[model samples]
Target: MYRIAFGTSGWRGILCEDFTFENVKVVTQAIADHVTAIGERDKGLIVAYDTRFMGERFAKETARVLAGSGIKAYFCKRDTPTPVVSFEILRRGAAGAINFTASHNPPEYNGIKFSPSWGGPALPETTGDIERRANEMLGEVCYRELALDEAARSGLLEEIDPRRTYLAELEKKVDFAAIAGLGTVAVNALYGTGRGYLDEPLTAHKVSVRTMNMHRDPYFGGFPPEPSEKYIQDFINLVKGDPAIRLGIATDGDADRFGIIDEDGTFIEPNYIIALLLDYLVRVRKMTGAVARSVATSHLVDAVARKHGIEVIETPVGFKYIGELISQDRIIIGGEESAGLTIKGHVPEKDGILACFLVAEMVAREGMSVKRLLERLYGEVGTFVTKRENITLSPELEAGYAAKQHQAPGEFAGLKVRETVTVDGSKFILEDGSWLLFRKSGTEPVVRLYGEASSAERLAAVMAAGKAFILG
Candidate 1:
């Protein structure tokens, strides 16, 4: 039996390695035990899977184990995104949801994310319980399988329609009418599940939109399925080649995170996307509340919030922190450096599909291009050049960076280190209003270096210096 380790969000591993049918059964039973421990075992559970290889089959296997354990599992019958499952957990008032997806990981990998009944990602405390139960499972899933017809007759299992409920709930958050009015928009699913909903709103409202990669491919057709810069050039080129196309939106595998392209066909960083939307929502929509952002996110948001006389709260480098704040506080918006975001009174989980629609509506309603909107935001919040690079470190250096080792240099690239902070990792604040961060990727052996510079050259220089330190 392979030990299943949980990341900040969920449990993930390569499909054939740590992730297997036997292991999935073990984890799902553990999840059943977790729900049972909370006195909700017979109250029921929900299961959903994405379009990846064997995701649906994995979801069924999990249900089989859970049902066998006497914990009824509400299985999602169709391929769907992670957020849709999270929403179902809350809407149905079930114990929680277990999703079969790897999020933005490569196609070869798969993962399981446990969402609480509130339709939000599980907290560390709760996930700890599930992990403890998983470790003790040891491939011995003690549960009795009930036939599907028998289970339904016993008032237990039911298949769900994630798309129908998800679409209905979205009307309250997205300006579907305004987005549909935008004449021509280019969207590339990157063959991810983001295709169906995005094209629907536009088509329903008579908006002229062109699409690509709409067909499903389990392998993602040899691409990494991350929707990162290199993986999304096809969509960028589509937007650039067509003069009528205004914005380009792409979602990662499982469709929880989004990557964007402006009218100029340049990928807009997620940090900027969050800040830009925050600016639009608060300034135009008259929403009132504080802003929550991860520590790794750009301070341009802080600048905007300061101008608006609102407080800014910074948390560790995960959406859980932001989501926790949103659940407890009257937060107008919460965002992370990655493309996950949530708004006030909406589902606490991040919704990339919602964000994509809102961004297009923001542009259409104001009669401004995404590039122009970002430029205006820069003018108000000051310029920011964000760059990230990763490299493998020697074992010794790995430990140091993992512990946030600091090297005091008088100046780096003609800019002095003004101050240093280590909230979650090492972050150096430069005198020129730029910063550099060195942090270890939780799931990989590489050390990631991020820098926000005041100029393009300074950004490049910081990257070079960081690469040299990490690779050397």
Candidate 2:
């Protein structure tokens, strides 16, 4: 039997391989046990899934396990976004939620994510307990499942659709009026659950919206359902060819990560978007609090916070750390370079739907395009460019890194390392204020190299030097 493991997000594995129906039942039973131990079985659990292959089947199976365990299951009637699940968990005062989604992973993969009653991703302590329980129950038929009809009859299962309620709450958080004045906008759901969560709201507000890949497609138009630059070329082309469109927005499979295209067809990186939103929230919206960002994010966020005289909390790469700060109401906004963010007063989970709509409002209120606003931001707080590359590691190299015997040089790309941070990985901060981070993937035999510098040319040099150091 495969030892069930959870990563920074959740437990993800290839379908029919490690993530089989039997494994899902085991994990669900473990979650049920955890919830019962906390005395929350009476409070019930929310169940949701994305638009992946057999997503509904997995979610129903999870509900069956919960029902058989004598826990109420507030099951979603359709595929839902991750943030929506988080919101529903808080709204219903449920014990927690189980989401069947691999996020942006390829179609062949599927996984389960558990969010606590606090409406954020489960932290290490919580996930560790669940993981231990799951592995112990593996290879044994330690689960009991009830039929859907029997579960419903016994009041252990109730179907629900939380979209309208979620969108109603969002009306207060986003300035739809400002977006309505911004002429036409384009949305690319990337064949995910973003259609009703993102584009529908704009259309309801009478904003002219052009949508692509809005319908559900398990294949995701033949690529992974990630809203990155390389995968969203069609959306970029649509924005560039159409002179009437003001902005182009896209979301990943779970609608938790975002991709943006400027009016001129330029793909604005998520690092810059996070910094821009932080600046806007502090200066324009008058929100006050510390800003939270992942260590892998750009230093430009630090520059903005410094300019505004606000504190900056830098956490490791996972959004859950940032979400912890959000849950405590300690930060005005928490974001990561991977296009995940959630603000204070919102569910303590990444909401790409909110992020996109807020950007539309930003453009409307500023009376400028996203590109122009970015220029204004650069004018205020210098300029920085960031890049990331992945390197596959050989067995020997992986062993060397795991042993901590292979150390990086004191200088790289002609810059002396001023300091090193071993928070999540090995980060070398250079004298020139540039930085490079080398971190290993938790699920794969690869290392990710992230760099940020004052210019694109300098960023390239830093990345090249980082590659050489890792390979050699």
The model with the greatest TM-score is 2
Q: Across residues 1-472, which tens digit of lDDT does each residue of candidate 2 receive? A: 5798988889999999899999999999999999999999999999999999999999999999999999999999998999999999999999999999989988899999999999899999999999999999999999989998999999999999999999999999999988999989999999998978888899999999999999999889999999999998999999999999999999999999999999989999999999999999998999999999998999999999999999999899888899889989999999999999999899899999999998999999999999899889899989999998999999988878866524678888999999998878889999999999999998788999999999999989999999988878
Residue 309 lDDT, candidate 2, scale 0-100: 96
For candidate 1, the clash count comes to 2
TM-score of model number 1: 0.94
lDDT of 2: 0.92
TM-score of 2: 0.99
Tens digits of lDDT, candidate 1, 1-472 = 4677888679988989888988887788788878887887766888887778898888877877777778788888777777677677777888888898888777888899988766678888888888888888776745456676776677667887778778888887888788876778887776777768778777877888888888788788788777677888888888888888888877777777888888878888888888888899998898999999877888888888987998999887867777777777578999988789888877777787878888898988988887788888888878887877777776777777633355546556777889887777777788888888777887667877788876798889977866665655
